[model samples]
Target: MGSYQDIEGQLRGKRKFFKQYSKIEVDDLPDDWIDQYYENGFFTRQTGSMITKKNAGEVSILTLAFLLLSHYPNEILNITIATSDFGIIALKNKVLREANSPPLQLNVTYKPPISYLSTDVSIFNAVKTGLIQPHDISSMRPNPKSSIFVEHFADGSSGLHETVIDTPSFVQICENPQKYTIVF
Candidate 1:
């Protein structure tokens, strides 16, 4: 969490594992996911396409769920994902069960505003885009960092991810509102 480089190195290992284990080529897979193989490049003959294909459906669904959560929080909270994929099903159960999880350091609407000027305002409305992670102290905080594919939002109110906005970034953003921004 402290070093972004270390985080990327870990992901590189994970990507290598995926590349080594996934045998199915991009052309043989769904059109929606073809770009992934293009991005990952060719793998060895030892790669397991059959095994990869078997799990592909669930992975796709889970990815969809995350993207959906990113845009429409309410839709995810009110929907169902009936698939064999334990991952997707787990996420469905989680969202259906928990209504208060915050993704990407973003929390649900606070129960009450600290002041009249601040209450009931969209973080987007109040701050510029990409500002959440910059201006706010919580953005750099130790979030239970999920992969790029994982949903940033909470499945429930309690266990989503940590929010640990680091000191330097926090100080910089706080001192200059025009300097910060939100990604989503």
Candidate 2:
């Protein structure tokens, strides 16, 4: 087993990645995460959607996951995004346009969190399979840099299209706290 110091180091690294990319403060995360970029210092696109500077970075799955882990120390989060919301689609397009990259045609399971914003089946499986143990932060520490989507697909198929959190999924995870307890 690795020492506690090693595990802590990994968590710190993940946090750093999140900070470097998202630039969102853990304490300032709005309850409505989809509206996060609407604040000042963010710019609006022709699509009427908001995103940070082309270089400032948007919040990634890992960044949001780490924020949840930091704030709610005693929860196991199961993240489920609709994968077709406008906010998300815009973000993907913006990232690609800014990066001058071609359409990254990969299964949902293969896209990097930095480039895309959708949560794949792998993330859900991690919680269900106990890889992200409920209520224990330590178990998640060792693989802090690991995308919240750590578990793999069973059938090896391409995953969901990248998108934003839809109304239903967002409400289910954030609003219905009691029923969807510990889920993000």
Best by TM-score: 1
Q: Which ten residues in a row have the lowest lDDT in candidate 1?
A: 112-121
What is the C-alpha lDDT profile of model 2 across 94-183, one tens digit per residue?
544433222222222223233333332334445555665434433333231212221124465423322343333432333322333221
Tens digit of per-residue lDDT, candidate 1, span 1-184? 2278865775686578455534655356566554654344222222555323334455455445545555666644433443322244344344334324432222333221111111112332344445454346445333321111111233432223223333453344344544333221
Please, what is the TM-score per model? 0.26, 0.22
Q: Look at candidate 2 and tell me the lDDT of residue 40.
A: 29
lDDT of 2: 0.38
Off by over 4 Å in 1: 1-34, 37-51, 87-184
Report the C-alpha displacement of residue 126, candidate 1, in angstroms.
49
lDDT of model 2 at position 69: 41
The lDDT per prediction is 0.38, 0.38
Off by over 4 Å in 2: 1-37, 46-65, 85-184
